[model samples]
Target: MSKPRSLDKSTKEDVSFIDRQPDQLTNQSVGQAEPEVPTGSDCAIAQQSSTQNINALPVDVLPPRLQEIINEANICLGFPKDYLAGAMLTAMAAVIGNTHTAEIMPGWKEYAILFTALVGSPGTNKSHPLSFAMQPLIDFDAEQAAIFNEAMKRYEAAMELPPKDRAAKGYDTNPIEPKRVRFTMQDVTPEAVHRILSENRRGLVLVSDELAGWFKNFNRYNNGSESEFWMSVFNHKAAMSDRKSSQSGVFIRNPFLCVIGTIQPKVLTELAAGNRNANGFMERILYVFPSVQSKVRWNRERKSPSFDIAAAWREILSRLIGIVPAVDSCGEIIPEDVPFSPEALDRLFSWQNEVTDRCNAEGSDTLTSIASKLEIYAVRFSLLLALADRACGDEKKLIDADIVERAIRLTEYFRVTAAKVQGIVSEDALTELQLAVLSELPGTFTTAEGVAIAAKCGMSERSFKRFIKDRKGVLFVHSAHGNYTKL
Candidate 1:
C-alpha cells in the first residue's frame, strides 16, 4: 500500500486531520522548511509571530525547577522517566495557559481513562509524588486546602465506623466534603464517588495504593454488588440531587474526576479471577506501568530530602489553575511532518488493537464504550508535551511522534497486564484446554458433577464457571441444567 499522505503543512495550526482518510502524498524528504521570518513591512505579522515564540520551549528541555518536580515525582512513584514526565506535562498543560487553539485541556470528563494505574514493586514511593511533589497543585489555595482537610476527616470517619453502619447508611458516616478529599480504593464508595464528581467540577487527581486490595474486597463485601457500583462510578452519568428542597431537582452530566491506582502484576491474577470488579476494570484506566525491573537503586538518603524547588513549582502551577486551552475552530490536522515517526504510530495502533481485541473476545462491551477515552488520554498526553515545549520557548504548537510513542508504550504496559488478568485464553489453546477437561469427565454429568470434573482438571471453581460462560455456544454447550458439555 502507498504511504499515507503527509499532513497538510499549509493548513492553519488549529486544524485536526487525525480521523480523515489517509491519502498518498508525494514522497518528500521529512521535516518541512521553517516559515520565513516576517520583515518590518509586515509589522503586524511579525508581532504575532514574535508573541507565539516568546515563551515557547521544547518539552524535553524543561526549566530546572520544573525538571526538579518531574524528577521528584518520578522518584516518589518509581515510575519510568517517560511515563512520569508525560503525566506531569499533561497535568501541567491542563492547568497552564494553553497557547494552541487545537489542544484540549486535560480534564477528567473528556477522557474515558480518568483513572491511571501506577504499578511498581514496593519502595517505589508510589504515593510520594502525589502527596508531596504535586501537593502544590493539589493544595493550591484555601479552597483546595479545605478540600484536602475534609477528605482526610471523612476517610478517618469511614475507617472508624463499623461495616454494618456503613452498609446500612448508604453513605459514609463521615461524609467527606468533596474539595478536601483524595479518593482511592480504600475509601472509594459509590456515594463518595458520586459526591466527589458532582461537587468537584474542575477536577482532582485520585491516588490509590495497592489497588489489588480494593478489587479483592469489592465482591466479598456485597456479593458482587460493589463491583456494579464501581462500574457505574467509572462510566455513569453525573447527576445532582436537591432532595432537601420542597421541589427537589437535579441535573446530569459528566463529572471531572481523575483516578490514579497502583497494583502489582503478581496480585493481578488473584484479583482478576476472584473479584468480578477487578476483571475488566483495568480497561477503564489509563495504564502507566512503572519500571518494576529496574536495577538502578534509588538514593536512600534522598528519599526524604526536601527539595526547595518543589514549593516554587507549586506556586507557578497554582497561578494557572482553571486556565483551559482554546479548541481549534479551523479543524487543522496535526502536521504529518511533525516529530511522530511511523514506528510510533504503529505502536499506538497496536496497543489500541490489542485492548480492543481482548475486550471483544470477553464479550465485555465496556471496552468499546471507552475507545474515545483512550484516544483522549493519548491526545492529552501529547498536548502536555506540546505545552511543555512551548513553556521552554519553542514557537511550534506541534507534537511529534515521540510523545505519542511514549504515551502508547506506557499505556501498552498497563493494557497488557489488564488483558492477561481477563484470563482470555488464546483461540489456539481454548479448544485443547476445554477438551482436556471434558475428556476427563463422565459422558453425562450434572452441573455439580461438572464442577467436580473442573476441580479434577485443576481449574478453580471460579475459573471453571467463567470458562463455561465464555465458551457458551462456541466450544462448550450450556444447558438449562447449568451443566456444560463439549460440542
Candidate 2:
C-alpha cells in the first residue's frame, strides 16, 4: 500500500533459544572462540535482533579439525562453508549410528541422528558440499556392494549343486542370499529401509540431491504410510513393515536413519504440504537456509590445500565406524550411554527451562513447535559435538558443560534458520497484492490502519478484512482488540 511505504522498518521479536553475543564467549581468542555462557540478561536479549543477522554457521563451536576442513573448502574449493558444516554434522551423526547416545539422565537418551536440509536455489552449490560430506559413506557403500557381488557369485554356484552334493561341499542346498551392507540409500521404500536396518543394525543415511522428490513421493507406493514410517524413523522408534508378498514382516527394534539433502527455497512450501507443518514432521527437521545465496566466483589463483581433507574426514568416520557396539544375547546392538557430567546436566536443564518458557509465551504454533523440537536438537547436538571432538582426538569421558554450551549455540543457529524458513514458506503462500499490503503494515497495526494500507494497495475493504480474518495465527496474530501483530 502506498508503494508498500518502502516496507516497514519496525522490528519484530525473534523467537530464539539464545542471544548471539560474540564478545561474551568464554574463549574469544582469535584462533577459535568457545561457546558463550548466557547470563540472565542475555536470555532477556534473545528477542532483540532479527534472525536474518545470523546467517553464518557458528563454525568455532565445532571440533577444530572440522572447522579446518570447512574453512579449507570455503577458501580453496569454493564451496559454501555452512552447507558443508550442516551436511558434515549429519554425516557424522550417521557414522556414529547406533553405537552411542547421549544420556542426560538414566532415562533420557538422545541418539546421534538428524534430519537436515541445505536450503538454497539452484546453482547455489548445495549438492556438491553434500556429496563431499557424505563421500566416505558412499565409498563404504561401494565396498559393501563389491563384497555382496562376490558373495552372490559364490551363492549362485552353490545353488547349482544337488541338495546332497551341496551339503557335502559345506554349502546349504538352499543358500541364503547375500544382503547388501549399505551406509547410504537413495531410492528406498519403507520396507527396504526396514530390511536394511534389520541387516546392518547400525543404521544408514538417506542422501537425496533434491528433497522435492522425497516429499512428493511420500505416497508413491501406499496411501500415506511412508510419511508415518519416516516420522517413526526420525525418532529411532521400533517399527515393522509388512509386504503383501511376504507372510512375515520385517521388524526392527530401535531403527536409526539419518537424512541429509538440499532443497530449493521455493520447494520448501511443498515440505509443509499434507498437514506436515501441523503434525510436527517439519519441526523435526533442521534447515540450513543462508540469508544470501550467490555462486562463489572462480578464483584462478586458488590452489587445493596440501593436505587431504577428504582423507582426514574419512579417517575420522572410520574410527567411529570401528567402535564395536555391544549386543545382547539375542544379537541386538546395544548403544553405550554417554551420560552428561553434573555441571553439563545442570546447564542443559536451565536451557530447557528457557525453551519451555519461550514455548509457553509464543502464540504461533509454528514457532512453538520449532522451539520444542530445538530442545530435543540441543541434546542431540551436544552428543554429536562431544563425539566429534572425541573423534578429532580431544577425548572426553562425558558430555561436559562446555560441550552443552556449544550445543546451545548450535541450536540457536538452527532456531534462527528454522524461523527464516517458516517466513519463506509463509511468504510464498501469499499473493502479490497480499504480500504488498503485508509489507506496508508495521510490527503492530490496528484494523483501521490495515484497512487504509490495503486500500492504497488497491484491495477492497471487505477483502482486506477477510484476508486478515483468514490468516490468523499465520501471517498475523491477534494482539489486542482491533490490533494485530505481524509474524
Q: What do the candidate models score in CA lDDT, each in turn?
A: 0.44, 0.75
lDDT of 1 by residue, 57-130 (tens): 12233434565555554444343443444345434643432222222322332232245555555644455444
Please give the distance, in angstroms, between residue 203's alpha carbon in candidate 2 and its true position after superposition: 0.6
lDDT of 1: 0.44
Estimate the TM-score of every prediction. 0.48, 0.84
Q: Report clashes for each candidate as comma-separated counts.
A: 25, 0
**Model 1 misplacement above 4 A:** 1-109, 141-189, 212-252, 270-280, 291-309, 312-316, 319-376, 387-487
Instruction: For candidate 2, write residues 1-487 as lDDT tens digits.
Output: 0110111111101223433322121211112223334333233332223323434566777877887777777767777777888999999898788989887767878898899999987777788889999999899989989999999998988988887799888787889988898879897766666778888788888898988878787877577777888888887888887878556798888888998889998888999888787788988999987655655556678778768999988988887877889999977889988878888888788877867775565445676788788888889998998888888887676888778777876787787677677767778888999999998988878999999999999999999988887665446655567887776
